[model samples]
Target chain A: MKPIGLKDLFVIFLKAGLAFGGGLGILAVLEEEFVTKRQALTREEFLTDYALGRIVPSGTMSALAADFGARFGGFPGSVIALTAMVLPAFTLSVSLSAAYVYLAGTPVLALLPLTILPAALAFIVAAALRLGRDITIPSVEALLAAAAFIGSLVFRISPALLLVGGGIVSMVILAFTERAENPA
Target chain B: MNPLQVALTIMVLNILTFGNGPALVPLLEERFVTMEGILTVDQLLYAFAIARVMPGPANAYVASVGFFLNGLLGAALAMVAIQLPAYLMLPLLRLHERFSDVAGVKRFTRGLTATSVGLIFASTVSIGRNAITSLTAAIVFVLALVMAYLLKWNPLLSLALAALAGLALHAAAPSL
Candidate 1:
């Protein structure tokens, strides 16, 4: 493997941020770019790595930065990857904070609550639909998703509980189904 | 509270909130007004307004509050505290790949992803309930959703159109 340099870090981070908006989808984007596009790893390999990224603590982007760096250029590669991934958004946030201190009190600010909030809601809904369509849910998985949605919305359950419950339910179903298919 | 305690609280809050920068708003508002005695409700709200109007992550807005309370070091500490989780977690996550082949683990990730989508939907419902105060607002919200889902419009463009619609509605019916 080639030594991962600053330029590689910058390219990966910029691409990850632009494609996935620096969120949960970073692994998918990275997989498509490096593994699928470059043919460095197979689809199965990429999916397994992505799954590992999610199960671990911390954000998916952080996991991707570390793993990708390690894969490309060992420990130093990991540093480059992580730095590139975070620097753009972190710098932008700091700069924006400086400007906000000046303009926050203006009456023009009221316009935003009336506009951006609604759009943000719409974005969330759209994201849910898009993700649901991508994942091939079996009947049991579908039930878990529906249950989690209702649990959060109607019961006003903590998101953490809903997530943990869904994970347990999926694990049970996956275990039973696998056993049925490969009984001794 | 002392600066060290404040810094620790901010760091823990940042990790718990999970989403990028916007997740810090409510937590900051509650802490700044109710606990820290650093800013009033009005000041916190104003900080929120300023944070949204300007670019960047919402966590940085807390630095503005820090600046108001204790000057340059306060501002720097607040920013560092909020961002430290991202910096620290990135390198440590490299070892995750060693368990990639585990079947049970993969199932858990799929479940978590689905649940995350559900949580996002719940949040959407709550935000929409608060934000769609008028028929015009509801219409703009629906239109933005349609543009995003059906027409594949860029989110920035949808946001721009919604803002224009809000401005027009406010002009047309000043009562709202």
Candidate 2:
């Protein structure tokens, strides 16, 4: 495929950002635009970017947009793509924040928490299941997962520390396992 | 609570978690609600509600959190802080050959991701304790799970149904 212009990159990501339902929703939009509609990237290329986005420590959609931008237009393109994708939600969040602050005491808006919070919890449960689907039961990964749950919920440890520490320990164990198996 | 603190908190959270916007909920609640006392549980729920209804990443709600704490400047800083870490991914992606070649990298990601899943569940329990205050809400929670998970309804549709149920239930009893 030919190189995509920065303007086109911005427009594509801007459209993707307008998708609701968060990250999964945005990914569908991006696949449609980049792979099927514009043919800017092949299906396999889009999937690779999606996988790369998963491992990076950022929102998957935002990271994917940056990667696509860097591919098409370099660093500047990357910045522009990410900005365009994030702008819509940021604007809405600020606007909603203003509304919530100003109208919080009213009875009508008070219903939001009663209605929304429960659903949000349900959403979180589903998200957790999706994230944990690959882990086998009674395994080392399960043990680490259980430890994280207890550390965050019971012991009240800093989640940032838990993630970093867990990742380093997991890497070392994996390295040792690999060395032991190969005997190199 | 100050501009610098808000920026740093958001930037740190973004750099640690890998996934969609909702992935930030555990760390975000830990910082703002449990640790700092910046916002109450209900306030954060309002932000999450608005985020789910709005377009873009759910993490965009960090702007709402910032706005609640310090107004427009906080919101702007939050957005910038959240987006900045995506650039960090650019460098890692640029080194994709070496990055993917390392077996340890994949294992490390697996471990981090599993832990994140656990944290998310922990936050769900924490948030649920505060949010599920009534029978109506409990019912809606079950209905939403069924719709969004089993039936595979769009979250927007499920949330809309939830809002309607809340209004009807609140009106019928006015006591819940």
Candidate 3:
């Protein structure tokens, strides 16, 4: 397939942004369009970008877009892809926030919180379980997770500190293990 | 909230957030809900709901929270702050060999991922305190969790059913 231009990228992401469902839903659409349908990016390349996006900072969805954009269209492409992907949702969220400020207490929309809160709780819990299920018990990663949980929830420690501490511990362990393996 | 302060806080939050927007929830709740009390838990949950209902990333909820705190500028700053890392990753893409080859990056990512997962788990309790108010709401929460986690149904689908259940419960017991 030929290289995809900026306009095409924008249009594709815009369509994705407007599509129903959230981040994962948009990812499926992207995979279909770029990997399966257009064959612009091979499945391997697409998956690598997706993985790298998750590894990097920011939300995975936006990072995926930026990574793909940079791959296809350089810096301009990255900006355009992210902007298009988020434009629709940003507008709606902002508009709703504005409306909610004045109208939240009103009877017709009163159930908004009652309904959304529990559902949101469900969403948060499910996300936690889904992510944690992959972690092996008694591993360093698990230890880090347990430590972070206790520190943040029980001690109210700063999350930044926990994150830095976890990363450093992981890096040190990895360094030591690698050195032990290659003592030539 | 001051716009500059909001932007700074979001940038820090973004750095700690690994994988997804939801990972940032615990940090956000601590900053906005628990520490400063800028917004109530219900308001933050509503922002999350709006982000879910709308298309794109769930992280866009930051914009709603920003708007509630300040206005359009706040929303814009939050959006930019949250997305800043993606753009920052662009230049790093050029260093693919060195970047991915570095054991440090992989180890750090693993650690961060673990930390994020733990925080996400912690957030369930923190947010649940405010979210799970009555028995009916708890039932909705359980059902939604089942649909999303066990049945592997779409989150949107679970939320839709939850909304319906909420409406039904409200009608039955207005006092609740």
> Which model scores highest in DockQ?
2
Residue A116 lDDT in candidate 2 = 78
Q: Which stretches of candidate 1 lie above 4 Å from their native place?
A: A6-51, A70-77, A97-101, A134-138, A182-184, B1-100
Cα-based TM-score, every candidate: 0.68, 0.90, 0.89
lDDT of 2 at A28: 90
lDDT of 3 by residue, B109-155 (tens): 77887988887787778788777878778878888889888998867
Which ranges of candidate 3 are over 4 A from the true structure?
A: A1-3, A19-23, A35-39, A42-44, A70-74, A177-184, B98-100
Local error of candidate 1 at residue A15 (angstroms) = 5.7
Order of all candidates by DockQ, from best down to worst?
2, 3, 1
Instruction: State the displacement of the C-alpha of residue A78, model 2, in Å, after optimal TM-score superposition.
Output: 2.5
Interface RMSD of each: 5.3, 2.0, 2.1
DockQ of each: 0.30, 0.68, 0.67
Candidate 2 Cα misplacement greater than 4 A, ranges: A1-3, A42-45, A176-184, B98-100
Q: Better model by DockQ, 1 or 3?
A: 3
Alpha carbon lDDT of each predicted model: 0.59, 0.81, 0.82
Tens-place lDDT digits, model 2, residues B1-176: 69879888888887788635666888889998988998888878778777767888868888888888889999988888887777666777678866567577788987788788888888888888988988888877887788777888887898889778877887898687
Candidate 3: clashing pairs of residues = none
